[model samples]
Target chain A: MAVNDMTKLTLGPIAYHWSADTRRDFYARIADEAPVDEVYLGEVICSKRAPFHEADLPETIDRLERAGKTVILSTLAEVMLKRERKATEDLAAMETPEIEINNAAGLFARGKRPHRIGPFMNAYNEATIRWMAGQGATHICLPGELPADAIAVAAKAARELGLGVEVQVFGRASLAVSARCYHARAHDRTKDNCQFVCEADADGMPLRTTDNSPILRVNGIQTQSESYVALLPETGELIANNISHLRLMPQAVDMVAVATVFRDVLDRARAVDDADAMLRSVCRTTPFSNGFYHGKAGYRRIAMASPA
Target chain B: MSLAELICPAGTPAALRTAVDAGADAVYCGFQDATNARNFPGLNFTPDELAEAVVYAHAKDAKVLLALNTYPPAGKVDLWRQAADTGTRLGVDAFIVADMGVADYIARTHPQVRLHLSVQAAASSPEAIRYYCESFGVKRVVLPRILTIPEIRQIRREIPCEIETFIFGNHGLMVEGRCSLTNYLTGQSTNMDGICSPASEVDYARHDDGSMSSRLAGFTIDCFGADEMAGYPTICKGRYTAPHRPEAYYAFEEPVSLNLSRLLPQMIDAGIHAFKIEGRQRSKSYVRNVVSAFRAAVDDIRAGRTANIADLVALTEGQKQTQGAFETKKWR
Candidate 1:
């Protein structure tokens, strides 16, 4: 498929922990094979894990850019440490490709250069979007939990302002982020000595209710929905609303195929049913949901009858 | 030295007067809508009640802070906007706002009314706080109960706004302003709906084996034995199972209230301008007791007294308390 015909797919920053080599190899392979248009790279989860992959970051970015994929650096979702702030400032200072501001630290650090605002920055209304656009944000990813109506309004506003708008199309919704690490605390370790045990769960540790019902997924300091969010059929609606980018969050499964499925659906190369089947085939998990878009329970499954 | 403002929660008109009579510097309450976090039935004030409460609070020299903190749903922002307008016209001292839209609206329309960033906004860091200040002209920020004194000091040094920290109350370990666990289970969020476990959906039943189960939306969140203190059915504080552990554990957080009376001097020195006590749904006696205690405690700290406060433990959630993420990040 021609790049112009393809729906822009951005690989959201890795929200889970992985070994440095694993992270490096994953991005390298994504640059080589993933059907993504752009890739956001950085430590949006925890600052402690950044140093492990810091050395390989530049080479990874180079590889992705060399693969004709746009690369954007992401700031931390919750910046607390001075070192974290310094790292964000460094990212902002670099005249690299575009930057995604996960928190306000990046916005402050960006100074005057145009940047992208990640969903964590909370641009709910048009005024907020306009304010962010004024602050040098060229692209803005609306928060994951915002319903379609709000997205429509923001997307309209973004269009009027000539800014790019992105939305999460797949992967578990990032529900919340905290200062405390439940992964470490679960293993009887403090935040200071977390032992980096979160790396053990590449996809996030599953949390179940007392009666053993799967309720949530714990990825380091962030909590995610247990049900995956898929929007293969909503491509037309999103496009109609002026959403320019479809964000595919990094998961443990076949993200490449996930990207391809979304790409085909967006390009009208495949029907929504075929894309849904292909997605199910590549998915290592169960049940897809798009309830947040419908303003219902986020876990509810909204089955689309057709690609239209 | 300025007396540390004692902001108290008043869920009802009676509670408002109780807090005011108990010497609260300010009483924060919410309308009986989805705009505030404590949207429990029989807890919040109606429009007339709020107007009366504002008059009552103003007469007693205690300010009224209207909490319009919930994130307005996509197409339903009118409710939040109307709430803000009502609060402004009703002579509210400030509008405690969490959602950016609400803040932006209040800043644009009611420029004179003070705006306090609700802890629900979860603007924990200095940069995040400054962004709010720079964008919306927020006068004060209610710091989330997750920062240590040193972190608070650092934030105070950077942000150009007055900082209010929770001194005694149910300290949430979960991320403020962004928690959706309750919404996931009960289809209502503290941020979006101003409720955690709405009373209408909560049910308590006894099992045959002498264990009691607390259910929210037909899903059992936690089960406690007869001897155990049955806590509220919040999904985060509920017991959960993991593959490694055979027994259930509090995956999100253990039930604990934040009591930082011991850290009064340090927090005050850290430039904490106001101290908030957090229980709006409690009894009048609770309001009177907790408010007077904290009011005296702030006075003692200001007067260079030892600042002894021990009776607060009984008012804590699950009858337990912690300094929480205030003293140190790792408080086990």
Candidate 2:
């Protein structure tokens, strides 16, 4: 097991507002067909999204667990309100699904209980990872802004501390989160009276410059990259650096098919070129970018060197 | 505890002296390297300059807090460590840090130095603030601009650390320490590289329509009208068009600065200990004007008199201001 020959695939927490049926259906399909080893459920972006899917959570968890998927609950990404604090505490007290600490509030609420640190918590270096490990962090999904060299160093440091290092492999990269909802504000509504307009844009509303160039995607309070980040070509490099997990953030796409492509590539059953082709076919709206890992503009897609 | 302290910014030694002479209770600054957030050219101070500034400020009964806030990559933490060592030897009153690694380095190496949680850490809730106080012995936390006065009171009641809130200057709506918009555009991050909208990559051009467009790394951030005053292209304040809304608008935030002068009394009543003015990249005159205005306002509040806000309007960004989330009545 220590050999780490194959890295595991994890579905990170959803940061958008999806309807109850849509979420239930999405998780159902993922539970039935996705080859992901673990699935994180719950809201990480806004607390408002919690009520919409709170009712369907148990059924969704049951379905995912029945399929032998390791289901983990994710805490809020930015906890400020009193209700948010209580909600985080309640999430930490849950007995079944493990908790992923997206905000530092979760770390404090969860105390020394074993948990997974989400990318939003700013696990940038060895000291943070080591500190989280001391506080009973078993896994850490580092921030997506890290380049390949930073990722390698963090992965090595995490391994030394006996923790799993998970990096986001595919999805519209998150750029920022604000207290005020840009999605609501854009629709001529305040954050309080948003009326859940974000649900309309399944993948998030595309924001472009005056020249109509796709620049960013706005999901309620969160800002994301217009281009989806695909790391199918960099799996070999990630594995070589001892990365234990690859996180595929849930997007409004055929995620099951997306997971199969990653699973096949990791299993050595499909070539990287074929997988990349399959990914392009599934990803329709946004261009593919791997620039963050390359230490360049996040929207730039660097052509990987042909498989070594 | 008697009155809220006036923490001001000092981009240079002149600004430092200006702020201190203007009745600043403390001055926060950083080194010129990428170890600090304001890594702009011709800004910040060297070790020797900082030592001199500290001596000058201490003579005026003002404190100097060194900002080693930017997160260093795993193997590249030495620069931050070295900054902390230099800051300690220079006799800085406190270290404003965001990354846990930086805080840990400061805590373990120089346990006596006071540690303040930078807004970049985005520790908004009480539990989050408690985590830092429990882990790194952080003495103060600079609250993000997102919180309300009531929220601050609630956190102050729940947490053990002292609280500092930005009273004026850039009103960043984005959650601090978490934003990557600058990195997405310029391949640089405010948290990681200590730069946002790096001035080197910023360009301004006049459109064919006779409007001015501010660009960040070749991407148009915001286009200003003929009569409009164009502010620096902070990515968050940029106007952009979305698929749902074709017309360009300030989708995230408008080009306005925060002036919490009206709510100074409420903030003080909320147990806010330090009132930080955010603009380390600004000038000595701007520093003197803002610090003097806020200093007068704080004194007036203590003497139970009217604290005027109109006197500071000329210094606000784009000549516009907002109470921000502190006075925000909107629900989220």
TM-score for chain A of every candidate model? 0.96, 0.97
Instruction: Provide the TM-score of chain B versus the true chain B for each model in turn.
Output: 0.95, 0.96
Query: Please, what are the lDDT tens digits per residue for candidate 2 over residues B82-187?
Result: 9999999999999999999889889999999999999989998888899999999999999988877887887888888889999898888788888888998889
Q: List the residue pairs that clash in candidate 1.
A: B120-B177
lDDT of 1 by residue, A43-145 (tens): 8989988888888888998999999999988988887778877887788888864888887667766766888889887777776777677777798898887
User: Candidate 2 chain B, which ten residues in sequence have the lowest lDDT sum?
Assistant: B309-318
What is each candidate's fraction of native interface contacts (fnat)?
0.44, 0.81
RMSD to the hidden true structure, all candidates? 2.3, 1.9
Residues A1-308 of candidate 2 have per-residue lDDT tens digits of 13233689999888788888888889989998999999998988888778878888888888999999889998889898877888998998776437898888888878888998988888988888988898889998889999999999999999999898999999989999889888899888987888889989899998889777789999998999999999999998998897899999989899999999999888888888988999999987579999999999888999987772
- In lDDT terms, how accurate is model 2? 0.88
Which structure among the candidates has the greatest DockQ?
2
Model 2: TM-score, first chain? 0.97
Question: For candidate 2 chain A, which ten residues in a row score worst on lDDT?
Answer: A1-10
